[model samples]
Target chain A: MFYAWPFATLLGRVLQPSSVVDTLTSPGIGRVIWFTCWQALVSTALTMAIGFAPAYVVARYRFRGRRAALAIITVPFMLPTVVVGAAFLALLPERWHGTAAAVVVAHVFFNVAVVVRLVGAMWAVLPTDLTAVARTLGASPARVLRHVVLPLLRPALYAAASVVFIFTFTSFGAVKLLGGPSHPTIEVEIARRATQLGDIDAAAVLSIAQLIVLAVVVWWSARWQRRSEHTFAAGRTTRRPRTRSERRVVAVVMATTVAAMVAPIAMMVARSFRTSSGWSLTPWRTLGANEVRPGISLGVDPLGSLAVSLRYAALATAISIVFGGLAALTIASARRHGRLLDTGLLLPLGTSAVTIGLGMLITFDTAPFDWRSAWWLPPIGHALVAIPFVVRSLLPTLRSISADQRLAAVTLGASPLRAWWEVEVRRLPGPLLSAAGFAAAISLGEFGATTFLTRSGRDSMPIAIDRLLGRAGAVPHAQAFALATMLFVLTAAVVAIADRQEVVDARRA
Target chain B: MLDVRDVSLSFGGPPVLQRAALQVPTGDVVALLGPSGAGKSSLLRVIAGLLVPDSGSVWLDGSDVTHVPPHQRRIGLMFQNEQLFPHLDVAANIGFGLRMQRTDRATIASTVEELLAVVGLHGFGPRRVTHLSGGEAKRVALARALAPRPAVLLLDEPLTGLDRELHDRLALDLAGILRATATTAVLVTHDHDEAATIADRTVVLGADMT
Candidate 1:
């Protein structure tokens, strides 16, 4: 209901067939669509290149520092795109700030985690014996990789690439902040047309096009993900690097990964601390009492923005848990229609956040149900967007548990409820906690949906940072950096707890 | 007495068990012997109330429990895979059923310790089930199944996966433990020697037997 009706209400404007033709024929429209696709394609390729070695290492070889490397890669992916754009805005050459290269670079930085986590999950359980068997049959190492490894990895690779493409395709906050006017994405264009130009006709057409593109990508990726889903063994052994050269390779790969992933974050934090005059904590100190006009009045401060974000994150997490948990259980229990139910529940995942926000604006404000101005609307949007991810992540773990486990508990004299608690819920602490972290973190960093819903004086951190950057002064820009750092720290802390819980789970095993 | 009568079940395919029947008096161990497709495990499942037969009545002591859920049946089962709870240590794993009964902490702890001793793993209480070796894991599973002191225990393929020496030793130890506790139980296995080692009466399940 959060997705389909509201989205359909907005897209139903497409009944004006003239608008579809006129919008497509409109000047600069083709450029927006072209930029969206091409940049996403390029960003997906770069992310794969940067993420492959780390994904492979995390999958095949076990080590102490790989956890740290994984953490570094993962944190960026969960970060809000606006903050990523802010980080590069702080780190890159000033001239590159509004260039196409800036958007691509930030996209790569933001999405390396997706490629790593998706591809790594599949690789960890991939049977190594097949490659060894090929070698025993006299296939060369390169040949083994080409024939045995790549073929096995294809499903995972396709799944990861398509996901990265969708994220980069729906690029909103980053493209808005970094893409500038010249390198506009369809999302930025829709935001501009609807909010700035009052061009709902054009915006509706663009939303339809984006929805079609995303539907195809989501469908394609789901197929590959299904093909890749066979790998969750009860447990599989991934060996620590044993030989001298192998150990060295692991060390080198880890060090480089950590350095590369951590640099932009370090730069952002350092920029937050320093100034034209010298290093100081003035920006942080002034965060609770800052103004857009510098000395005129106090305005969008980091403390208020942090509180706003935390509240939203907390609300979103709670909402997603109830809705997403029930959805997963419902899907898991459906004997014959589980796949169909899962696809239907995951409907919101196929639409970009901006589309949801825009749809809400279109659908909820007028006529029959005019509750668009409700305070719960934005958090609800975040929850709807997050629910699909929570369901997807929970289902595999839920399904991996055999019916025998629950029956084992039951025949041990546990009540059916007690059996479920003992076998199903107890085993799910890791996946559940991680999914919660994703919900909270995704809400904390969510910009596209929140941006459209932004109101002055109560701006979220992402909104505050975006507005602060639009101002022309050291203090405003410094405050933007300060808030971005706080956003990063908040997001990272949440994910760290979830990440460590995963390791703790393995330790128990 | 634990009695199964006219127990028939199929999982959407060829019949796994057809009108199978068995009876075990209190404190008597029965070993079910069958060929691979003769439904020895399926029969164990039916008796334990994990599976409801298409047509059957299960009697515990006197009353028919054909439609009773597994937990209400007061029956215990040690799975073929030794489905030990991976999250729990050896002690907690053994005490899970007692905890479900809302047994007091001290009694649960004492019972867990006693069962650990009975299984010949005196200090294994704190060790995670996942950390235990194969033979140790089997002992833990047995200890766990027996901890609740069910009216009857159903063990499926107790020593099937162990090496020959381990299998022989475990079978002997298993028989000793069953007799020591006077535990009423049904064990399913294909090996006739294992049946001879463990059961007072061996029941062969096949087309020729009921």
Candidate 2:
């Protein structure tokens, strides 16, 4: 009901007479779309350039703080795009704050970790000896990398690039906040048409257009990722850099990536501390206290928003783990229908949150199925976004498990489901916990959908931060920064735990 | 011809290879035999330019190639696990070295076909390496290593995991292939009988080699 009902209503509404034809003929919709595509392409290219070097260094050579470096770089990926927007707005110069360049930079910052994790995982398992063998066969180091390593890494590269492209293309929160009024993307325009302008028909048409484009990209990327999948036993053990040049390259890449990732976040935190007179923690201290100010009140306290965010994250994580685990298990075993379900689950990832929120509002406003007033509506939205992450994390571990173990349990008199539970799910506590942590991190920072579903006086941290920044004054701006900092710390903690669990799972495998 | 002079290496443990020295004349097949942990594979790696020895040098033909990168060394080392590129087919794996040398397509094709026949994988050019059985993969690995006709080919326990009957049969087949190619090579193995059967000459390194 949560996923299909909204999506069905969305498609039904979009298919109404003259809806698609009218939207397609509308002026500037093409420009919004064209701008979206080119900017996404630019952001994807920049993310690849920035992420590939660090990924290669981390995968190929072991260095001090290698894991820590990877963990640190991924922190930005888990932060709310609202926080990301606020950070860039604060960190960029006045002229650069609300430019297309700022939007592209924030998108790259948010999606670089996707490349690092996906490409690095594949790179790590690749047999290093293949490269050595190429070298010994008279290929130069450059030729070996180009012919041998590049060909082998092609699928993963395409997969990462496509995924990053899809993410940047469907981006909502960052572009809307950072791209400013003049630089409206399809997602931003869709939101404006739906909520601010109260034109649901136009929004439905835009949503349908966006979904069609996303379907093609998502299918292509998934196919490439599937093609790249290998069953090789992980053999390449990382070692210290063999030459001074190698050492230098590793140092430069690591230093640059860490600085780029950390600087904006550091600026955001520093902004929270600075008052009109001097540096102070007054904004943070008054996070809960509702002292009257010149700007917007937000009605809900910041601390209350933090607690609400945690509660939603916890609820979303629980939902994601259960649904994601069941979906992965079915996909791993079932033949045709399971495959369709697998693709269906990932549709939410490509679908813009604005569309989902609008779909929910239109679908569930009636008497019988009115979930619009439910406290769990936002968590459901967060869970919809988070389930994909949980599934992505758990599927590999589930597939790696042999089926004979479950069969053995079945032969010992356990029911089929019970056998699978004992053999597969019970033995995967580490992966389950890791998936849950990832889901929690994703839910904790989710902003795009939350912006629509957040009830007044019941805003999540991201919604509260967005509201505080929406108000025009020094106090509200400072409070937004403070809340963003809190989110940064919370997400960092969750990601740290998740990363350690991933490492443990990799080792165990 | 290849030479290793007084090579020493340790991974913060008791030195795996201490003052290890060996020499083989052109077209000579020499086997280095030792127990498990005697660093026979390490010695082969040091000679193959995969590992740099602590305080010694490796000479290929006549020049010192101690610091040369593995590719520039023009040497081949077949690891114990074969490590065939799973992405390529059998013929492509065999022709990889020739292609790296930038040989013409026809010549590479003919050479690969000849090597496949010699490895007894005739007409298996398009077969994926993952489908090859244990003994077949080993033979393909040998063919691949010999394709470039390196100055020295290093084999580390190539038959270690095979059954005894298959191991002995492959040892004899390998002996015939090595002699036929006239390729100077170093074979590292712990099995006495297999080494004695395959190598023209054998050098046994003691547990406490100085």
Candidate 3:
């Protein structure tokens, strides 16, 4: 409901039912879609192939430093795409930056974390005795995996595959930063049509098509997740690798999974400190200065952008928490009707980020609702996307507070509002803090939509990095890397603080 | 003969099984009687080659098979949890071992059909294993373990969770199946009556024994 006014109005204004066919069937549009499909397919296939071994190892093995290994694998996925793409650019040769291979490599790093977490958690609850039974029945280790483990894991695999496909298909920030003119995606096409070409008709048609495909993938993924979670009960404890070969396999897996993830991020942070003559922290020391290097005058200041990003993050965090908490309470209080609201709230997730960005840009710029110059406009857009995530992360904990607990308070000489305060308010700080931190982190690194909303003087950190990377010379690139590192650290610090707070609250509760 | 010699094992703490040894002559059944967590299941895994012990060797027919993989040992194990493949139907689950052995489809089908009847589920070949009752799942697990006709079979508390009437009925059926095939077997259980009913000899694995 938050974005419905803008989206419906913009669609009504720009999308003519008659011209939808003419625009969708236009020549060269097929190439945009073909590139989208093949790249998504290739990225999903590569992610699944590279991610399965590590996922299985993490799920089924008990070893020292397992949590640390998992955190290393997970950190890349948490960082903003602009940061991730900038890191890739620093790691790869400049000539390879815009090629399809670079795009696929970036997508792999971006989506691999999803595969590891999703499939690993699914495989954890699967009964290990099934594999043991198969072994005793004369099946070799490979045969047992082929016939038994694969079948059991099919649902989760499909779910993860579809999710990766959807995200890759409509991906904007990574594609915008990494994809050059030769490899254009449908998402980039929509952004171009809406912003640069003055062709709202074409943009509307493309976004609608993208929206349909995304909705379908989202629906299918939900079905697979339901089936996967429903089919099996948790059983059997995971054990440390007991044999020589088992321990060797675990060691090799650890080295590969952790090393593959940490290298690019480490290189990005380290490269920012290097100069033509020697290693210096000039970029780090001078990043906040209006003029970064002696000879260059880059208009966008990294320091100023940092302040802008923090302001927007604070506003977005406040908006999402208040609205998301109320939404979760409504959903929990009204179970039957809440299912519909639950699906509706998650619609923003299924919708393309490019489409949402365009919708906000257009709807506010027009006459009747011209809030385009307002300082909080971009944050409002950020909050629109952040609320769904907040609601999702907070729903389970909200539901865990049973109605009986509230009723028990009510029966003991407390009014209904007082009862809510006594029960939910007392237990809300942990989950609420985590949710707010998540919203803040998202706004800090949000690249896809922020790319569109950066026409204002105030630029977010991701936009600053993108503009810096686009400019030539070593200083600009160094500043981009420096800013990327700062963004990375800020996002990581927020996540770590939230995680620590939750653990502390968990112990207290 | 199936023999386990001085199998000692621990999980980085107190030993769960220490200096445990057992020998079963061909065509005879032995029961390892112990309470829960007495390491009877761990010892059975060691003999089946699913787990390697700290100090032990498993011998089958005068050949050391301790370091061999479980698939090559020809020792069938029916898990206490009856870990039936939820994805496979009854006949496919029963025929899994034969398929692994590369038996012809005709032979696999005949063996699966006959074994389903032996376990009193003759018409259950097409049914999903996930829908089976607890007792039925155990019967299918037993049938699947027996389908390849292992030289020796291991049952790990196979009837522990079933109700009294079903347990008694399944015990009789299990004993009849074992004797009729003349299968060399070892069964582990915490129930004294179950141990007496299913084996020719009973050995104790207690805390003090470990």
Candidate 4:
């Protein structure tokens, strides 16, 4: 439903010979495409550069509060883009807001966590002995890094860069807020053409172009990452910093990462409480009031929007849990096409959410199936982007159960289903809860499709935040910041609790 | 020459190696025999500069290298499981040590070819390490350890996992290679036949033995 219907709708329009030439010839479209590629490249480079030291520190050294630091850094990756936009808006001076620099910074804030996680996971497993062996052969530390460590980490680096690139390339909400008027990405351009200009053909052409690029990048990254995906037996036995310089590096990296991740959200929270005289809770207290901004009346009640978002997230969680769990089970048992099915499941994550929204708009607007006004449409849209997370989280945990355990159960007179239930399902609550937490987090902060489907007064949390930030009043801005802080705390708490539970389970196991 | 003095070590339990001392003259192969959990591998790790002893020092050629990092110690260790680099082919694995020393491409190629020949795997250089049989992989690992030509080579149960016939064959090959290189070496093993076949002298390590 996510990729097929969207591509089919896009191809229907793109197949026209005039559409391609028209989209390519439009000077504005050409510029949007160029700027999108340039920013994505630069943002991916910056994210990789900023994330490397921290990832190395986390993976190679054991320090006090290291695990907590990892969990905290991951919060930004799960945050709503509008919240991140609000964070930068609150943190940066007025002169720096709504610029290309702001957009790039926000992109880095959102994506650096990905590089840290992917590269750090790989860096941890790599036996320290390989480098030790190289050193014994007269290689210096720098030489060992170049000849031994870099070659080994190249695949993970490629994968991280690819994911960050795709994310920045398809960015919408942050680009909408932080990019101002002069800088529009392909996704931003697609949203404008589809919603504002009603230029469906141009949107379709751009969607196709973005999908083609995304597919190629994802495929190449997967090819490289597959080489590094071996089951590592030797666990990460981290040690404390052994030298003064080592201690300094760890301190600096950890300090910078914590500040970079935390300060923006902190500023947002602070801004929520700031009034003309001093800090107060007036903005939060007025969440239920419909405030007027100059001549315009903003009718949204922040609490109502929060409730709507919670309901949508709950519905999305249910849908994804059922579908993703069944998909994981099928893939685990499948002897053929499993890889293809896995890739298919992940296609929605790589494709632009704007394209999927437009696809749903056009495809579901006719006869008895007019879901344009349905409350369930947004949750379904959220599910399309969320099921992959569910499957990815559950599939690995499910696959990790050795088949011998099930075989042993069956040999003791249990049926196959009963054996699987006893050996696998009994061990699944931890991962399933983690998957649900991830799905709920994604649903709560989902903005791209919600922006398309939501009505003015019945907006979800992210859409409401985006709308609040768009208006011209201190009240709207404060409400947006307060709401963003709320979303941040909610999502962070979910993800942190999930991670903590997983860690506790790991210790027990 | 290698010397280990009073190298007692433990992991918060009963000592694995207590007041252990050994000396090997230049160009001699000495085997340390012990049962499982008898600290034979732990002792080898200490000598190879991978582990630091609690109250002893290690000397190589009359210089105390106890505090030297493993890489700077110039000691070669082939693990019991034959820890070949899975990402590299047989040829690259054999030449990994030389490459780390920044040896030129031509010399690395020749040295890898020679080592492969020494291990009787000349034609198998291009094969993936993962594709190799267990015995073949062990040979590649041996070649990699020998390629650096370190001062002291430590072999930890290099023949333990092989079949009986292959073990006997590789023991003879290993003996010939040691004699040909005149390499100062320490072999850790529990099998008495393996120790007798590979070493000039044997040292037994156990709670009852001093």
Candidate 5:
């Protein structure tokens, strides 16, 4: 409803049924979709291969520094795409740039965390009974995993694959930085046509096409989720003890995962602190220096942008928790499965943030609906991006509260609201706090669509870093590195807090 | 004090309890006995107002309370596991019902202490529920349920998971507590020995009830 007008009108004009049919038949569109499918498929497969062994180790064994290793593996998932791209750029040799191979490598780097976290968590909860039964049937470990474990893990694996596919399909920053002209995502094309060439019609048509593709993928994934005929007994899985060979395998996998995940970040940090002569603190010192270029300053300060980013992130987190928490509770309480409502809440996740920004820009930048000047647009944009995560984090915990407990409370003379508060709300603090922290981190690091939505002079940390990278100067580049380092530290802090809450919840359970 | 007349209930596929009727006078503990999947728990659920039977009437104190919501029925249910709120300490768990009823702080505190004494859990009020032993937790669960002075109490396999000695001791303790409160009670169990130990009258469930 918010973006109905411009989308309708623009669709009416540019996506004349005739042109859409033509674009559908065009070889370019097919090529683009084919490339997207191939990239996402390979990326998902590679992520699984690289992530599975380490995830299995973490799920099964108890060893020194295991918790720290898990935390390190998760850091890439929390970092913004642009920062990940920047880290890769800093690490890669100049000669090894602007190739499809580089883009694929970057996609794998960005998505391995998704596979590890989702699959590893699922593995942790697998019931020991299944494995015991298989062993009694005289099955080896390899045979059990192939026949029993993998079949049981289908839902999580499919979910992770769909998420990775959507992310890579709409990937903007990494491809833009690594592949340049050689590889352009539909997202990049939409941005180029809309902002650089002033072709709203073309941009609108492309955005609609992207939306259609995303809808189909999401719908397919949802169907797959419903059709997958596997449900494991809850709260029954136990960890296994590692043998010598198993221990060696676990050590090797952990070392590779950590090294792969951390090398780029290490390079980024090293770059943040280095100068031409040697290691120096010049970049950090110059982070706050305000040198105005000719006729460019519109009262925008770097420090002010930092404040704005924090303010917007805080607001977005609050909004996400309230709305997302309510939605989760409603879903949990519904007597029947709410497929439509669930899909509606999750649709924004697959739709590119830049596309959403464009949709908002087109709808709200003019007429009686004008809200471009309200200073609320950015936070609204950030909230849209964060709500899906909030729902994801809250749903599992909400669903885990047994129905019998709620009934027990009610039969004990508690009102409906009181019963819910005692039985449901009491268990929600950990997930809610963690969701809020994730939302704040997302808002802080958001760049792609934020670049399109904000005013020309106003900037967030990511946009500031992008500007510094674009300009041809030593100081600006150094400042960009410093700002990137600061953003990384901030994101790492937020994720650490969220992970701590998760640990606390695990202990309680 | 409580009467259930010709109750029939189904969960979409098949009826779990059909045309089942039972009665319990005040201060009587009626044990509902059945094997697994014989709808013993479902009967208890219906009595506690957690499930709405297809055709039935529940009378408490000569008033029809069939349509009353579970919260308004003044019934208490204790599961095999204690199901104590993990986030709350023993005192808060005991006072949970009073807090829900919006009772004053002084009354809540006094009732919690009184109930703790009855359960022989003095000075355990501030301890986390997670830290309690199996027997101690069951005692606390009983105290919490009885703190609100419910008109009826329901227990579902309360001794199913315990060893023989602990189970017998807890069963004896629970029966004594129920007698002292003069609360009409229903106890569901698969073990005939447990039912005989705790109940004043025993009713055996059959496939016809399901």
Candidate 6:
């Protein structure tokens, strides 16, 4: 809808032969598309390289500090892209400023969690019996990995790759902050045209193109996943003693993962506390101060932005629980003709957030659904993006509920509704709570699409930090550092709480 | 009485059972003994209404129940794993079937208490299933399946995971429980001794049972 009128106008203008030729032969658009693909591919490969060995180690071995390593790998995934970009900026040498390598490195740093969590979790569940059988048949360790492990791991690996590709393909903040003019991704181009040039037509075209690319990638990945079929034996023992080679591999993987995961975060922490005079608490103190600008009477307060962020996060979490819970229940109960509904629920996870924000802008900016002027748009947008995660986390637990319990209840003379309540609904507390916690964390850090929907003076934490970083001053930069630190701590707390709940549930099971 | 006539079942690409027939009179404990791959479990599943036979008819008490779901058919199934709800306590597990039937709280509590006594698990209601020893868990699973008062009970290798002493004792106890309750059951197992001890009649199954 955002592009309808502009496209029509362009079509009208291109009715002339000369204009039509120009439109068909634009070099700038082609360059943007080429650069977008290049950067996304490189970022995905680098992320997998950094994440795969560690994930393999975690899945295959039992060692000290495994839990801590997993936590560190997942922390970046929960962080807002703007915060991660800011951390990278603070950490990278100023000499390598405005380079493609910087953007690729930042993308890798942010996406390591995706590869580890998705691939590593599935790898851990592969049956040990398959490997044992292959070894007993005299297959070498490397051969077993190639023939036995890789075949089974293919589906999960492809799924993780598809996810990482979509995220990098929609690269916005990291590329904008770190990329040179020669390496602008399509997402960065879209943002620039919409915000700086106000070329809504160009931005819409780029967004539509991005959506098409993502759809193709997702389709290909789904096809690959469906064709690969192998089921492992259940109830295989997972706690095997590690051999010497396994021990060395695990140790090396752990060291590399820890270094890659912790370096940028350590850099951010150091920068937050550093001062010209000495290491000081000036940044922390300035978090509450409001510095007035030249010729402007009012100054934006960092604390005020923080409060708005908290309010939005809370609201988004509540909305996600309500809407996402309904969607999950519908999928769980729709015994027949449920495949379409399930696919619809998962569609948001693959679509780019920026494209969704653009659609919302086009659909709701006027007429019967004029939500542009309302304060609810940002939270609603965040909820739409967070629903997919909630569904993914809850669906597995729901599916695993045994059929006997429900039947047992019904045969005992209970009505169907009563049986459902007693058997399934009563057991949903663990997954629901954890999913809500994750949605809350996502809302707190979300920036990509929220940037498009947020009205003037209604900046989120990421937006406020971006504003502070853009201005040239010591106090603003310090305040931005402090805000970033606060955001980090808030997200860390949410993740830690969710992690504890998961551990408790696992122990109980 | 429960009857299965010319039942067939197949998985993804091939048939596992073809035109299998069986009958159980009321209060009869029949054992279906077979080798590992003789389709005993599949036949049991078909009778329990968990799997619909490709083409067959099922009758319970002279009523056609071929289209009924497992819950509506009033059948109880116990797996070799003692598939107790890990989240629920012993008492809760026993009362789960009754609660599903929406029995009144007073009745549920009393029935659970009676079953716990019968299983020699008095005062064990509050303990979590994960804490139970192998023998205790198997008993709890049996109590759970029996609490609902199903017309027919299905036990799939109920004693497979127990040690020899526990298995022998539980088999005897189980037979006594079935006789006391006058419940009809179909026991599926590979152990001839277990079937001999617990069943009133045993049907040996082979690859060509169909």
What ranking of all candidate models by lDDT puts the best one first?
3, 4, 2, 1, 6, 5
Q: What C-alpha lDDT, on a 0 to 100 scale, does residue A278 get in candidate 4?
A: 70
State which candidate, 4 or 6, has the greater DockQ. 4
For each prediction in turn, the share of the native Cα contacts (below 8 Å between chains A and B) that it retains comes to 0.00, 0.69, 0.78, 0.41, 0.00, 0.00
TM-score winner between 3 and 4, please give it: 3
Error of 1 at B136 (Å): 38
**Runs off by more than 4 Å, candidate 4:** A1-7, A60-66, A226-252, A292-296, A319-343, A364-371, A391-435, A496-509, B4-21, B34-43, B52-56, B62-64, B203-210
State each model's CA lDDT, in order.
Answer: 0.82, 0.84, 0.86, 0.85, 0.77, 0.77
Per residue, candidate 2 scores C-alpha lDDT tens digits across B49-163 of 8778878899987899999988878789888888887778899889999888889999999999999888888999999888989999999999999998888889888998999
Q: Which digits, one per residue and each the tens of the lDDT, describe model 3 over residues A1-509?
A: 54897679557855587768877688889889999989999999999989999898999899999989988888877788888888888888888988889889989988888899888988888888888989999999999889888888888798889978987898777888888777889999988887788887788778878888888888777787677543555775578987788899999998898988988888898889876666888777777877755676788788888899999999999998999889888987788898999998888877776777778877777677777777887787788878888898788878889899999999998999999998887788888888888898888888766656666468889989988888877777888899999899999999887777777877876
Task: List the candidate 3 regions with Cα displacement exceeding 4 Å.
Answer: A13-18, A225-230, A292-296, A505-509, B35-37, B206-210
Docking class of 5: incorrect
lDDT by residue (A208-256, candidate 2, tens digit) is 8888998988778778767865445566757888667889999999999
Q: After superposition, how far is residue A216 of candidate 4 from its true place, in Å?
A: 1.6
- Which structure among the candidates has the greatest TM-score? 3
RMSD of each: 20.9, 4.0, 2.2, 4.1, 21.0, 20.0
* TM-score order of candidates, top first: 3, 2, 4, 1, 6, 5
Return the clash pairs for model 1, or none.
A290-A299, A291-A299
**Cα lDDT tens digits for candidate 6, A338-377:** 5787877666776567766766665675677787878888
DockQ for model 6 equals 0.01
Docking class of 2: medium
Query: Considering every candidate listed, which one attains the maximal lDDT?
Result: 3
Lowest lDDT sum, 10 consecutive residues, model 5 chain B, at B79-88
Expressed as tens digits, the lDDT of each residue in A17-120 for candidate 4 is 89889988987987898889999999999999999999899889998999789877888998888889899999999998768899999999999899999999
Off by over 4 Å in 5: A1-15, A18-34, A122-152, A225-228, A231-242, A292-302, A332-337, A397-428, B1-210
lDDT of 1 by residue, A38-64 (tens): 999999999999889888888889888
TM-score of 4: 0.86
Better of 1 and 6 by TM-score: 1
